[model samples]
Target chain A: MRYALRGGKRLRGFLVLESAALHGISRAAALPAAAAVEALHAYSLVHDDLPCMDDDDLRRGQPTVHVRWDEATAVLAGDALQTLAFELCCDPVLGPAERRVALVAALAKASGAEGMVLGQALDIAAESAAAPLTLEEITALQAGKTGALIGFAAEAGAILAGADRLPLRAYAEAFGLAFQIADDILDVEGDPEAAGKRLGKDAGAGKATFVSLLGLERAKARAKDLVTMAELALAPYGAAAETLRDAARFAIARQS
Target chain B: MRYALRGGKRLRGFLVLESAALHGISRAAALPAAAAVEALHAYSLVHDDLPCMDDDDLRRGQPTVHVRWDEATAVLAGDALQTLAFELCCDPVLGPAERRVALVAALAKASGAEGMVLGQALDIAAESAAAPLTLEEITALQAGKTGALIGFAAEAGAILAGADRLPLRAYAEAFGLAFQIADDILDVEGDPEAAGKRLGKDAGAGKATFVSLLGLERAKARAKDLVTMAELALAPYGAAAETLRDAARFAIARQS
Candidate 1:
């Protein structure tokens, strides 16, 4: 399990902490929620990299869990990590039981059938599909596969504070789309050593992506527009949300 | 997901309901918890039947998830099912947020590395060990793999009612061990048609089990003694727990 969680950009964890701070929630109180998102994200990556799934041998520039240990270990480790996510959310330091239960519910919805898992199933189905997905379809697919968890992370602080989550939700939606678009851009041009994994698998598999459907320049332009929208969504918090706005910009600018 | 859940005896669900009734928690309010345990059990079976895991082609008399669909679908379905378990535990009908969070925490601990997953990991490790597990080791392995969740199910009512759980926990531990011993007995002598899956796989793989270590007659006797202990554990609940007592008897008597 430690091997699977070794390294990452920790973007989702950052969202949880940043959003919590925006709501005036202490970093100490929000730490478990931050760790929960990272653990859950790690679980998804472990499973996605399984031999029966993407069959990748590299992740974060290290041997994948299945390659390092074995398939059974990878599966079990992923399963336990997923369970750990829920367990961490129930920690007492997260504040009231109501808040913790709320977090658990939101996390489950975002990561389960109606969210990430649905996105995965659709992606798998699309592989044997008669034609590549359209730009609109790809957006919808990414919304579930990646957008849901990101949205949950951003909204987590609001949930913890019992505040309205609409602002954070809007920010996450735009930011998540921008992030995916940037990922496509990175795949097309980023150095493999910097990205820490194979960069051209989407094209190699003939899969549709934002860049594939929108063209390189158009994709980059779309990402920029989305980042602006993400930044604007944080206007309700004024300068207090500057870090979040910077995060939106960073999403599109990061190499990995 | 529904395919994976079909046709089980639902002993875990029954335990949840029965235990809840013992604590005066109405079945209506306890239904989601009942469903949660069943979903979790189904998820475990689906993943356990994966090609890299147990590699079983059949479960509950039907083609296993991996066989019915494909490995990728099976993996995603199992992942979603596990997520569903957490979601179900958060159902508002289950009661206050405190109770729900408590349930989620207990469920996560029971199913994760400290419990069921640990047992599974130990089982896999034992497969390639220098020698077959000793009787004591096998007992310890089954305690986690099977006993943990069963204990959770049995204690869920007490949790819901904010009642003491020690009695139910004791009952469940004995019942779970007895159940596994009965399973080993069945594998040795039960009909494949009745058992709904391949029989004798443990012995075929040279794995140590209650029947192997204790001999058929002795194992049967041990299970009977366990049923008595399970029954005795329910003494505090008086006639209200008679059905649970019956369940203990049924655990050993059932063919499947």
Candidate 2:
């Protein structure tokens, strides 16, 4: 579990911290929430790399948990990491009881059956489907699988501050799509050496990703448009949320 | 997830409900907590039955989740069920924000690293140890793997009612050990038809258990003593706690 969490961009965690900062919540107070999201993400990745799932051999330039240890260890580690995520959310340092409870509930909703799990299930089902998923279908699946947790992270500050979550949620919804499209773009054109893992997996699987459905140029265009919309959502917060706007741009501009 | 949830004894859920009722919390209001514990249990079972884990096909007289569906489905279903457990804990019907937050925190503590997961990890590590675990070691492992969640269920009512938790916690600690001992006894002497799953797995795996360490008669006696202690812990509640007492007895006497 520690190995799985050892490295990453910490994007989701960063979103939580920046959003919390906007609400005047201290980094110390928001640390658990940030860690919780990252832990949850790591768990998902660990499970997704299992033999019965994506069966990937490498993650972050190292052997996947199942490959390095064994499938049973990977499964248990993922389960424990997930449990830890919720435990972190329950930390008293998160603030008032109401805020803590709200964070717990929101994280659950974002990660559970109706959110990330549903998206994953759909993605699996799509693999065996007679026809490939349409653009809209892929979009919806991405919304759940990738967007839900990002949405939760971006909205955490507002939730902690007892402010309206709408604008941040809007920003997250757009930002998530852009982030995934960037991933799709990476899958098509990325250097495996730079990415530190296998690339072009979607093509190998013959799965319909944004790049598959829309072609390279159009997918890039769509990602940029989503980034623009994500930035626009911060108009209400003005310069107070510039870091978040940078995060939006970073989602698209990163090479890996 | 639903399939995994079906056809179980619901022992943990029952404990939560009965404990809540004793504390003057309504069954309706407590329903989510009951369901939450059951969901968490189901998730653990589903994951434990995966090919790389326990590799069991049968559960509750039906195929296990991975056997009935696929390993990927089992993984996702377990993950979703776990998330659902936390979400259920967040239900407004659980009580005031403070009570709800307490439930979330307590449940997480009981099920996470310092509790169930740590137990499971130790159990897995025991498999490759140079020597079989001692009786004391097995006891500690079961305390985490099986006892912690049961402890949480048994204490849920007091948490909800803002009552003292010590008595129930004491009762739960004893009851959980007795319950595990009963399971070990069944593994030694149970009929597969009655048990609804394979028996003698511990012996097959060369793992130490209560029966292996204590001898059958002494183990049974230990279980009986534990039940007595569990009942004695409820002395404060007197007759009002009779249902819980019956549960303690049933844990040892049940065929399955």
Candidate 3:
């Protein structure tokens, strides 16, 4: 579990903390929420790298959990990590019980059948599919696979404060899409050494992605536009959200 | 997920509903929790049946999720089912936000590294150990693997009503152990057709169990004693807990 959690941009965790800070919540109090998102993300990655799944052996430049230990250990670790995510959300330090419950509910919605899992199932189904996914299909897949959790993280702060989550939700929708697009772009052009894992596997597998559907230049342009929109969505918070604005840019700019 | 949930004893869900009734909470209000536990159990069974884990091809007299579908589908379905458990706990109909949060927290603790997952890891580790587990070690493993969730289910009603949970907790501890011991007994002597799934696999695999460690006769005696203890623990509830008492007796007496 610990190995699966190590070495990531922690963009989701960053969103949780930043969103919490915007709602006048202390970073310390919000730490559990940040940890929850990261743990959940790690669980997804561990399972994703399983032999029956993506079958990846490298993650963050290190041997994947299944490779480092064994498949059973990896499965148990990932399952435990996922349970830990919900446990963390219930931490009293996170806030009132109502808020904690809200977090748990939102997290379940985002990560379960309705969200990330659905996206993954779709991706897997597409692998053996008769035809490559269309642009719209790819977008829908990314929305569930990546957009959902990011949406939860960005909206968490507002939830903590019982404030409206629309602005942050809007910001996250664009930011998450931009992040995936950047990942697609990276797969096509970035160095595997810097990426820490194999690149171009999507194309190798004949999987359609933002890059495949939009082409290199067009995909890059779309990602930029989404980042801009993400930044614009933060207008409600003014200068206080500058770090978040930078995060939006960083989403598409990071190499790994 | 639905396929995975079919045809279980549903003892855990029964405990949740029965306990809730004891606390004056309507079964209707407690339905989500009952569903949550069954979902969680189904998820565990699905994952445990994977080739990398227990490698079972059959569950509930039908093909296991991975066997019927594929490993990827099984993985995603299990993952989603777990998430659904937490989501069910957060159902508004369950009661106040505080109660819902408590359920989520407790469920996470019971199902995560500190509980069932830890027990499973230990079981896997035991498989390759230099020697078989001792009687005490096996007891400890069962406590985590099987006892934790039963404890949560038995105590859930008390949690819902903000009542003292000691009596119900005590009852569940004894009941759960008795239930597992009976399962061991069944594996030794129960008809495979009646059991609905494969039996004798534990002894076949040379895994240490109550029957293996205590001898079949002694294990049967021990299970009966535990069932008595479980029934005795419900003395405080009087006739209102008759169904639960029946459940305890049934735990040891059931053919499957």
Candidate 4:
């Protein structure tokens, strides 16, 4: 489980910390939520790389869980890590019971059937799709696949502080879409060495992605636009959200 | 998800509902917790049946998730069901925010590293052990893998009613152990048709089990003793606990 958690951008964790800071929630109070999101993300990656899933042998520059260990260990490790995420959310350090309950509920919603799992199911079904997915279909898929967790991470602070979550939610929505577009862009042109995993898998599969549907140049432009929207959504936070705005820009610029 | 959840004894869920009823908690109020545990159990079973895990092709006389659908679907369905369990716990109908949070925390504790997952990991490790596990080691493993969830289910009502949990906790501990012993006995002597799945698997795998260590007669005696202890723990509830006593007896006597 620890090996699986090692080496990542830690973007979702950062989102939790930064958003919590914006809401005047102490770093200590928010750290658990940050760790929780990271653990959850790690679990997803572990399972996604399974022999029966993407069947990837590499992740984050190291052998994937199933490749490093046995398949049973990989499966059990992922399961345990997921349970750990929820356990982290139950930490008393997070503050009021109501807020803690809200975090549990929100995380469950974001990561469950209506969210990440739904997106994954659609993605699997898409493999045998009669035709490539439309832009709108892909958009919806990415919303659940990537957007929900980011949304939860960004909104964690507001939930902790019992403040309005609208602004962070808007920022998360734009930022998440930009992030997915960036991933799609990476699939078109990325160094597998730096990325720490096989690149161009979408293209190899002949699957429709942002790059395939929009072309590389147009996809880059769309990503830039989404980043701008992400930044603009932070107007309510003003200077306090500068770091978050910078994160949006970094999402597009990142190579891996 | 629906297919994954079909046809099981629903013992964990039944424990929750019955325990809740003992404390005068309404069935409707407890339904989410009931459903949540059942969903969690179903998810565990689905994953356990995967090719990488127990590799079972049948469950409750029906094709296992991976056998009926595909490995990808089984994985996703199990993942989704796990998320659904936490979501169900977050149901507003569960009552005060504090209670809901408590439920989430308890369930997480029961199902995570120190609980069910730990037991599973140990079980897997035991398969490759230099020698068969001792009675003590097997006992510890079963407590985590199977007993923890039962403990949680039995105590959930007390948690909901905010009553003294010590008695129910005692009842649960004894009942859970007895339940496991009965299962070991079934492995030694059970009809595949009645049990709804393969029997003699433990002996077939040369895995250490209660019956193997204690012999059939002594294992049966131990289970009877535990059931007695389970019933004695419910003395405080008196006549209101008769149903629970019956459940304890049924655990040892049931053919399935």
Candidate 5:
């Protein structure tokens, strides 16, 4: 957890909080859900840092959980974090069954195998990936692996905010794509210093990329389009959803 | 999944089906929920078999997931089954939001850390268990680890049947304790051949046991009392819960 916080993306937290506020849910009401989401994000990184997984030695310029502790300890700590996220869902501030269950359901999608694990699975599966992946297959794989969790985080705010399913599901899809495109672009163009680690390894590995598949110009357009779609989903909530809107644009546009 | 299906006492599934049937729910309407409960049961087994976790090699005369397919796949498969339980809850086949969400909540409790994973943590923690676990502490561990899921299954049935919470919870709890006690007895005195595996390891490990803490006869009596109590919880349901009553008696008396 210490290592996880070193390179904290306060932006993600801000997006979650802002959307909840827009929805008129109080700080106390949203804190648990927000904490759970962030914890989940951290836990993903912790596991992603593992030798068999992403194999990063450092995160946020600090030794990762696996490096600081050991592989076994890192594994257990990640397991503990997953458990803690669920426990926090009992955050008494959000007592309504409708909202709580909604948050829980979204979290499951963002963090579980179908979303994050499946994504990681694909990343590893592609280590020796021979065939060129089609646009559809790449989209599906990225959606399940990287995009799904971000989609969860974005849509989670709307759910907590009491937004209906149409907007919630819509923003979820858009933000998910936006998040993936941003990460992909970063890999292609980002300075290793700015990204806090390696860059272009994906291309070196011959792994598929938005740039590789769609070209840089087209990928940039796709990211912009997704950001616009994400913002429009929040239009239903008027200004309350603006923070989420801004975050989507910043997420895709920010160089780092 | 094949190995996960082999060794369960099925006490949890029994309580769920029994309680629901008593409340006038048809078997057809109850199928999905029952399968879900079973899947949860299967999932817990799969996780419990991991190397960094229980390090167990044998289950129901078969190698565990970690032993059979490697740790990563076991982890992923467990993750998939858990989300599958939630998706099952959303099945169009399941009726009445009250029952569906309630069932989902119960299912989550069984698999999540505080319940099963926490129990496993405590059990594994015992390898270097910092403190001497009292009989009560050990019981709590088993209750949370093993009993809670079983209880969830029973409660799932009652929720589907639309039974009141008081009866639902009561029936589930009694069955949980009864189910664990039966395992304790089986471990101590039952036949390995009938039980489908070895039975003497817990004693060698010096793991907590009812026979060690409460004596064999006292534990046997306690198991019987728990069965009686489980049946009493369903007095309101009468004949509808009769199968549950039979299962409880079977649990304590089973040779395996």
Candidate 6:
């Protein structure tokens, strides 16, 4: 539990909880689903830190799971954490039986291999996606790696509130893209103190980043555009989606 | 679909369907659920064969995914396939609404990091798990690595059949152990021509096996005992579980 809470930005979890609230999903019911997504986010981080993968040693300002334990234990913890996410959703205390099922479906869609795992695979692929990629390929990579999880987070929030899925999904895709752009910006100029991850690693790793391919100014402008698109997607949602809209601005505007 | 049929031992999917049938599950609904489980099994094989992980060149006598395509595509395909498994279950036509939810819940439990992925992580860890493990540790390792997925498959079958879970789970555990034992025996006796894997690679890998630690005769005997135990666990379901009972025997008795 301590490990679960310590380091994640929890922006995704917060977005989920807040969006669920916008749709009038009760706080009592939203926490487990909220935490489940967080567990998945955490699981991805742990796995990314493996020696065979990203091989980072520090995360959330503490030793990465693989660093603290052996690579095997870290792998086990991540796997356990993933299972725990679904288990939490299955918890009977969350909501009505039907609501629980809907949330599970959305969460499963986001957390599985096709969603985030597929994205990770692509991220790995991007290292060799022919040096600089075409804009379309980069967009596809971000959508899979970063966007899919965020989209799921947004859609899951809507599912939590029993909200209609169309608008929720629209907001999800926009925000997911926006978040990745913001992440790209962070790689260029964000405060090192806050992200806990070293800056400029994207270039070092030969990863394709918005700034790397698009130039810093263009990338920054694109980030703003994505944020706008995200906010526009939620416009139909009105004040109920305030937190979501703010998240859009925060995605691009934040220092870290 | 044909690719799904042609590769590998049908052990996991078979165990699942038989257990479900034991609880009087109709084959019509169970077949797709079995396929869903099989897809997950196949996806895992695809990823596991990647150069970064197992690095095997052959799986069921075909070039492994990473070997056929680059690692990234293989990874992405695995992710896509995992999502496809859940998508298959979510099909509106698959079952009653209630059963669809159950299927999703079961798949989420089995395929995610907790079940098979966690097991694989441990398998990686066991590459050097503190000198030879105690028999107890070895059992725990096998349960996580091999037993969990098989157990998940069996339990899924039982659930798909609409069987009450209590009796189904007990048999699931027993068959899981039996399946692992037979695998260990195959490592000792099987020819690569028949087995479709590099024969005796287990000993060469320094990985502990039930047969490796115990004599071959003892391993074979333990497997038989496990099958009997599996049957006893299914006793409450009576004659309906005959396929499951026989499957446990077949699972342990098979040469390769």
DockQ-based class of model 2: high
What does candidate 1's lDDT look like per residue over B1-256, in tens digits? Answer: 9899899899999999999999888999999999999999999999888988889998999999999989999989989999999999999999999999999999999999999999999998998899889999999999999999999999999988888999999999999999999999999999998989989999999888999999999999999999999999999999999999999999999999
lDDT scores of the candidates, listed in order: 0.94, 0.93, 0.94, 0.92, 0.70, 0.71
User: Clashing residue pairs, candidate 3?
Assistant: none
Judging by lDDT against the true structure, name the best candidate.
Answer: 1
Candidate 1 regions with alpha-carbon error over 4 angstroms: none
Superposition error at B149 for model 4 (Å)? 0.3
- Give fnat for candidates 1, 2 and onward, in order: 0.88, 0.82, 0.95, 0.83, 0.14, 0.30
Candidate 1, pairs of clashing residues: none
| Cα DockQ of the candidate 4 complex | 0.85
- Choose 3 or 6, whichever is better by DockQ: 3
Per-residue lDDT for B36 in model 5?
Answer: 71
- Over the stretch A1-256, how does candidate 3's per-residue lDDT look in tens digits? 9889999889899999999999899999999999999999999999999999999999999999999999999999999999999999999999899999989999999999989999999999989999999999989999999999999999999988889999999999999999999999999899998999989899888889998889999999999999999999999999999999999999888989
Over B132-161, each residue of candidate 2 has an lDDT whose tens digit, in order, gives 999889989999999999999999999999
Off by over 4 Å in 2: none
DockQ per candidate, 2 decimals: 0.92, 0.82, 0.94, 0.85, 0.21, 0.31
Q: Is the docking of candidate 6 incorrect, acceptable, medium or high quality?
A: acceptable
Candidate 2: global Cα-lDDT? 0.93
Residue-pair clashes per candidate: 0, 0, 0, 0, 2, 3
> Model 4 - which docking category?
high
- lDDT at residue A187 of model 1 (Cα atoms): 91
TM-scores for every predicted model: 0.99, 0.98, 0.99, 0.98, 0.79, 0.85
Per-residue lDDT of model 4, residues B85-172, tens digit only: 9889888888888888889889999998899989988998999999999999998999999999999999999888888889999999
Candidate 2 structure quality by residue, lDDT tens digits, A69-99: 9988898889889988998987889888899
Place model 3 in a CAPRI quality band: high
A114-158: candidate 5 lDDT, tens digit per residue: 687787777666665778677787888888876776666666667
